[model samples]
Target chain A: MKNLKYLISLIIGHLTVFKHIFKKPVTLEYPEKKIELNDKFRGEHAFDVEKCTACGTCQRVCPSFGTIEIEKEKDENGKFYPKNYSIDLNKCIFCGNCVQYCPFGAIKMTQNYELADEKKSTLKLEINTLKRNYFDNIIDK
Target chain B: MDYLYFLYLELLHKWNLPDYIAMVTFPIIPFCFVAAALIVVVIFLVLAERKILAFFTQRKGPNRVGPWGLFQTIADAIKLLCKENITPEGTDKFLFTLAPLLAFIPVLVVWGIIPFCNEFDIISFSINSLLFVVIAAIPILGILLAGYASNNKYSLIGSVRSVAQAISYELPLIFVLLSIVVLASSMNLKQIVLAQSSIYPFCGYFVFPAFLGFVVFFACGIAELNRCPFDLPEAESELVSGYNTEYSGMKFAFFFLAEYAMMFIMCAFIATLFLGGFLSPLGFYVGEKLIPNEFLANLSVYFEQAFWVFVKTFFLIFCMIWVRATLPRLKSHQLTAFAWKVLLPLSLLNLLIVCLIKAVL
Candidate 1:
């Protein structure tokens, strides 16, 4: 039995290497090929002024304190709406918690993953400036 | 004395250079080239082995430096170089300094004998076959140098252990080598390779009658290299650096470089010994006969031979890495005793079987 095991091992040893001969060699060569970050990539967050009801739902949903900020404006009708909905995109975890509870798809994730900026403040997401490419791509195709 | 003569002939006589320059600079070039090449090969082998193992393990290996971590070795070299050339003051400074080089140079010289491609041939053959064995015998000296030179307690123990381990494995490895020489009846490696050509067609490799010999040789060769499972000397968690506890800087790197160079050579040696030494496995009889162009046929023949040889060697290397990552290192006595009680006996049986087969055939 030991001899059989040894013989089996000896024969199987060379054969096992063949398993990797055609394997999907897990190497990405990353710099050469950018990662195919999925649409559900859960990346930097964007603000949607047209849709955000300004219920302060997102601010409450944000686990990281000071990640989202809401400004208020009162109309003559005595109704309050968000004057500005801003997110420190740097602090946003892209947890999609805000997305789940968002009654209106006001704040959501964007596809822009390379968010690196020279200035720290460059990462700030102003509702007015937030590009809707994430939503646009979702709808366009 | 001999090397100094090689220095003069190569530098002064051949190049018509000044004796001072020849003596000072010329000898250094081969050494430096060898040293540099060995270092580079070791780094490449380590990266490659890691990457290949990662492939098997389903993960990305060091992929940060210079795209796929090509510069990772450079970073390592820099770090190792800058760290420290610390020698325990009580150590035999000269031998401690020399140990890694001694452990290293044999592996490098083995490459001097191995032919990589048809064009990569580097060995110079001579009358006495003893020279090949004599040069091949240098690694033991290096192992001894490493063991005895370092004055540390563990280094002394590890060196002695390694010497025993190395010498025990050496017997089987040599027997396998001799088995090949018996078949080809030539000590010259080039002749051994030439004999593997498609003259007999199906029998290009010496693996048929010598199959057991080749297998035993490869197994013993791995043990001789002192890799994992067989890595008794530097079995970390026991002996910190084994024989290399006291070595550092370029000396340590030389040892490191030598280890990988030997691994590469061992693969090449296995290829040369069994897989038809640069003879196209497919080119056996048919292609050689049908192809009108001799050069084209021979070129294809060599290319085919080189491919199989490379495949076999790399596969073995991958196996070594797998064993390294999978198994535990053997104890010192178990390491030597296994060689004596198991591999030694098996190799002798293999030798007898091979002889009987030859006699009957």
Candidate 2:
């Protein structure tokens, strides 16, 4: 009978729920356990000092003004190295254009994406921190 | 000496209290116990429902609090208590303030007649079955008042839907309960439980012959409580938070508590009516065999009876939660039609069958 099937189906539905009680939950508890990001994830920028030409290509390609600042100051050999290189993460959209357009791959996106900070000034990445991060993450690892 | 009688005398003697004062104080004691126990049970029931629902949906619910989110409801309760009690602008201030209390107080009041065990019974009124029905219906009036007093259109529509759903479901519920009344030959809840103890053709729980009615009663009860699968009144997509739309902070908490408490009360009522109340499901013979020590055995019986009552009640509550997790909310028309067309006729037939069996026997 149709009613009998309905009753059996109801029992089956309940059994399904009962079965799920034993199954492992799929939720990854935030902060304690973060999901692994893919290779393509456009995250924090890392600057390779040895490879960077200080050609100001990154600053020019950046769509958002005031995000990437590159200053050229001549070294003792009269070759230009960046005098003041800064990336304001507050303005950087993480579009990866800076990483993509770099001919020498001087700038790269890192796997570290936990970028939240209490202060606005802290979010801005300086040349020293960027170079340190690049050497520490890319060259050493 | 009867221990109850011994305690009665010793209490009066120790306190130097008069007989009238002792008698007056005796009833208030169980009332306080029931009130305390109900709140504690509601707190756990809310947590259990959320956890079970999460499990059914295959997600971890509320695991951020104390281990496995055990204290999540406590944190929620504290937050509700601390939040600003907001009364929206241009509302009927007096009735709006009164509505949540109206919704809440009746649920605690209904526990006045519900017997946990023979010794723990507060009221033990002869017509407690009828008393429960009357008291349970009173919350709807509060819900309606809440909707009207809020001066909100969504709330008014929700109140109307709630009333419609409640009235339709109430018919089949009362009818099913009436069938049980016919079988038990008394309206007292304690008497109904007692009547189920006699094993005539089999263990004389009316659930066997009145299976149809039991099903009807449960479905109607879900509708009456405005729970999921029958929760059209507060349908999230249709009406924003329903009758309690304008309520906030502790007032909203009252409505929330009352709903969960009512769920507990209904589950306990089902246990009493159809699942043999505080009596062991395996019966006394099994209990005796399981425990041979006379002193411990005697002590265990009282505790065991109360424990079984809680077990049966919680099992029924879990089933209700399971249903909530499994089923989708019914359309408003389907909800009404199912009550009138399917459950109403089935309950009527069930009542007729019960009366015929009662008369023949």
Badly placed stretches (over 4 Å) of model 1 are A6-10, A88-92, A115-141, B1-91, B107-137, B140-161, B175-199, B202-206, B232-249, B267-338
Question: Which candidate number would show the highest lDDT if scored against the true structure?
Answer: 2
Task: Name the regions of candidate 2 deviating beyond 4 angstroms.
Answer: A1-15, A54-88, A95-103, A118-122, B1-6, B14-16, B83-90, B198-204, B285-296, B353-361
lDDT (Cα, tens digit) per residue for candidate 1, span B1-361: 2433564567566767766775566445545655576666678888988777676666777888888689888888888888777877667778776667676666666666665455444554642233445665677677677777676778877777777877888887777777777767788776777776765664767887777777777667778777887887777888897887777887887777777778876777777778766665565535457789986775565456556666767777876787665556777677778778877677777777767766785
Residue-level lDDT for B265 in candidate 1: 69
Q: What iRMS does model 1 reach?
A: 3.6
For A1-141, candidate 1 gives per-residue lDDT tens digits of 887897788567646754664567665675677778776877666655656556888788789889888887876777667887677877877788887788887666767677788988878877655646445644454
Q: After superposition, how far is residue B57 of candidate 2 from its true place, in Å?
A: 2.4
What TM-score does model 1 achieve against the real structure?
Answer: 0.68
- What TM-score goes with each of the models? 0.68, 0.87
lDDT of 2 by residue, B21-115 (tens): 76667667767888899889989899999988999888999887899899999999999999889898878999999989999999999877766
DockQ of each candidate, alpha-carbon based: 0.20, 0.66
